[model samples]
Target: MRILVVGAGEVGSSIASSLSDAHEVVVVDVDPERVESLTYSEDVLAVTGDGTDLDVLREAEVEKADVVIASTDDDETNLATCATVDTVSEAFTIARVEDTNYLDTWREHHGAFGVDFMVCTDLLAAEAIVRVVGLPTARDVDPFAGGSIQMAEFEVPEDSPLAGETVAEADRFDELTFVAVIPEGADHASVPRGDTVIEGNARVVVVGRPVSVREFARALDPESAASEVEDVVIVGGSTTGKLTAEKLVERGVSVRIVEFDEDRARELAELLPSVTVYSHDATDPEFLSREHIKDADVVIATVGSDERSLLAALLAKREGAERTIAVVEQARYVDLFETVGVDVAVNPRRVTAEEITRFTRERRAENVAIIEPGGAEVVEVEVDEDSVLAGRTIQDVMADLPAGVVVGAITRDGQYVTPRGSTVVEAGDHVVAFVQADALEEVTSKL
Candidate 1:
């Protein structure tokens, strides 16, 4: 597929990098430095021009593109880019917007802005945060097979019992499958073997039924795991924070919003009747202590600025918050935030890029979860007669595919199917597989 990605920012570059190896990718940016940098960094062609301009689109050969993605930071710019692309090509257009109003309007009338699909960055980030909050000790979480199957990543704490155990020893859950183990400081994840050790500070990725995943979360840190999170404190009145609180409230969890702005706090109080909104500076340790933040199940910081969010999250953690989740605007700071004691750092751009990538692979993948930015992915596909797994047993299929491909789970007729060596994959079965970065293209082609 020939993909034209507009706005060579973090989200656009991420999408281009992920697809460049498998598809013809062209990236456009207004900054000459960014364009030149991307040209050298990735295999994709980068053009220096305004993406919303007709001349720029023509220069990028938009007519031959199979997909045109508008990922500029501004919602108006993305919508304009998509609308402009539609005038010259029949390529499927996707727009990435941060505003929910645009998303709601587009949903009411599909293709309203000449966009075939749209990804809302804030909403995706909020959903990602909520998913992590659902599972205790899960640094990241993605659902597949209509929520029946979950791919969860957990950091093995230095003092945890599972720290020195091998994958085989941690494979006690009946319905869970250990997928990958990313050692500390590693950029890529390796599909785990039975003998792979679960070292301290390493992150483990697993796929299984939600119940089993939840059980594994408890086992990861038994003393710290809670049956359910009862209270959550959000340290901002941003869109992502509001969405996160809304979802948590739906789950019957008590929520509190600490917004420094008095008017915004009042607005949030009106918007979320069930949630407690406090108009005070979240960074104030005295205010946090007064609000019982130490007793809260989780503290989320979505203060809009990376520095402030990091400060708020770390302070909350220091104040004895059970867990801290921060919304990181910069993708590069995700690892730093987690390394500094933030339980989870949700990158809105990364989440948006992953969502857009899922649609780009609509030919086979029903859903896609990027475990690590450009490292590994968990993809869900419906096996057809032409698929390699159609009538083959797990063992035979493994022998045929690349070494890093692991059939995590399968669902047929809306029922979970545990994948084993003897289990044969039938046509129409929804198969979820963990694919290392290098093997993703080949594994997807075969599956």
Candidate 2:
């Protein structure tokens, strides 16, 4: 597929980098610096001009593009870019917007603003935060097979019992499959074997039924229980924070919002009567202690600024908060925040990129979750008659596949299927497999 990505910002650059491996990608941006940076950093064509201009589109050969993505920071610019591209190209159009209003408008009319699909950044980020909060000890969570199957990533602390155990010793769940193990400071995730030892401060990815995944979460940290997570305190009343609180309220969890602006606090109180709203500086230790933020089950910092969010999250962690989740705009600081005691760091741009990149994947892929940036991915593919595993047992099919591919879970006719070496795959079975970056192309072609 030939993909044309507009606005070479973080989100657009990330999407281009991920797709350049499997497709011909072109990037358009107004800034010459960004265009040159993208040109040298990724294997894609970078055009320097305004994407909403006809001459620029012509220069980029927009008519020949198979897919056009508008990912500019400004919502109006992205919508106009999509509309402009639609006038000259028959390419499928996707627009990324931070405002939920545009998403709601597009949802009411499928092809509104000449866009076939729309990704709301704040909504995606909020959903990610809620997912992590729902599962104890889960750094990341993604649902597959229509939410019947889930892929969860967990960080093993140094004092955890599972830290030094081998994969064989930790294989106690009946419905879970260990997909990959990423050691501390590793650049990529590797397929785990029974004999592979899990080191402390490492991360593990597993796929299985939701119940089994929850059970595994308990195994990772027995002291943390999902049922015990009742109170949540949000530092900022940004859109992401508000949406997260709304979702948590739906789950019967008590929510509190601390906004620096009094008017915004009043507005939030009116919007969410069930939530407790306070107008004060979240950075003040006295204010935090007075509000009893230390007793909350979770403290989330989404204060719009990276430095502020980091400080707020760290302060919450220091104040005896059970867990802290910070919204990081810079992807590079995710590990730094986590290392400094933040329980989880959610990058909105990264989440939006993952959501959009899945649509450009192979036709058989129903859903995709990137385990690491430019690393391993967990993909859900429906097996057909032409698939390598259509009628063969997993063990027999393993001979034809590379070593990095691990079948994580399968679902047939909406029923969960536990994958085993002896399990024979059916034609219509939906298989979720973990594929390392080196084997992605070959594995996707076969599956």
Candidate 3:
């Protein structure tokens, strides 16, 4: 497939990098330095020009492209670029916007801007934060099979009993499947073998039913796991923060929001009557103490400034907050935030990139998730009559698949099946597999 990606920013570059391996990718950016950097770093064509210009799109052969993605920072620019692409080509158009209003209008009016798909970065980021809040132990969580199956990543605490146990020894849940073990300081995650020992502080990825996942998480960290969330504190009245608070309030949780701007704080107070909104600096020790942030079950930092959010999260953690989740815009700050004691760091750019890439996947795949950014992916595919996976046993498929690919679970007629070597995959069944990024193409070809 030929794909043209506009704007060469973090999200655009990430999409280009992920697609360049299997498709013909061309990236356009106004910044010459960014274009030069992408050219040297990724296996794709880099064009230097305005993405909304007809001549520039023509130079990149947009008419021959299979998908055109408009990912510029400006909402107007992204919408206009997608409209321009629709005028000159029959390719599918995707636009990335930060406002939820545009998304609602586009969906209600049936592609008002000629965009076939629209991705909202703030909405995606807020949803990511909510998922982490619900599952406190999971560093990241993704649901598949209509929410019946979940893929979650959890870091083994230094004091956990499973820290030094092997995969076969640690896995005691009948409903859970251990897919991969990501050791501390490792560049890549490995598909777990029977003898793969989970070291202390290592990150482990698992897939299973929701109830079973919660049980497994409690088993890993009983002291930190809560049966239900009660008190919650959110810093920042930004769109992402407001969305997070709204979701929590809907779940009947006690919510408090700290906003630096008085006007915004007043607006939030009026909008969310059940939530406590305070116009004060969240980084101030006295302010946090007065608000009883130490007694809160969860602290979320969604401030616009990355530095301020990091500081607020650290302070909340120091004040005895059970879990801290910070919203980070910069991709590089995610690890730094985690290293400094934040329970989870959500990156909007990476989340948006992953959502956009799902639409560009093979037709057989119902959903695709970037389990470990740039490292591994979890794909949910349907077994069709012509698929190589139909009518095959798990043992036969594993022998034919790549080394790092593992069949996590399968659903037949809405019944969840923990796949074993003798399990058979029939047509119309849904199969979820964990695959290394480098082996994605080979794995998809066999499906």
What are the per-residue Cα lDDT tens digits for candidate 1 across 358-394? 9998468999989874468899999999998889999
Report clash pairs, candidate 1.
Answer: none
Q: Give the per-residue lDDT of model 3 (tens digit) for 1-447.
A: 899999899999989988888889999999999999999999999899998999999999999999999998899999999999999999999999999999999989977898999999998998888887788688999998999899899999999878899999988988889988899988777899999998988999998888888888998988888567888999999999998898889888899999999999999999999999999999999988887899998999999999999999999999888899999989899999999899999999999999999898866878888866445888999999887788989899888888888888888899999888899999999998899988998888888
- Give me the overall lDDT of model 2: 0.92
Candidate 2 at 35: error in angstroms?
Answer: 1.6
For model 3, the superposed segments whose C-alpha errors exceed 4 Å read none
Q: Which regions of candidate 1 deviate over 4 angstroms?
A: none
The top-ranked prediction according to lDDT is 2
Clashes by residue pair, model 3: none
CA lDDT of every candidate: 0.91, 0.92, 0.90
TM-score of each: 0.98, 0.98, 0.98
lDDT digits (tens) for residues 1-447 of candidate 2: 899999999899989988888889999999999999989998999899999999999899999999999999999999999999999999999999999999999999899999999999999999999999999789999999999999999988788778899999999998899999999998889889999998988999999999999999888888875456899999999999999999999999999999999999999999999999999999999998988889999999999999999999988888889999999999999988988889999999999999999988856988889987446889999999999999999999999999899999999999988999999999999999999988887888889
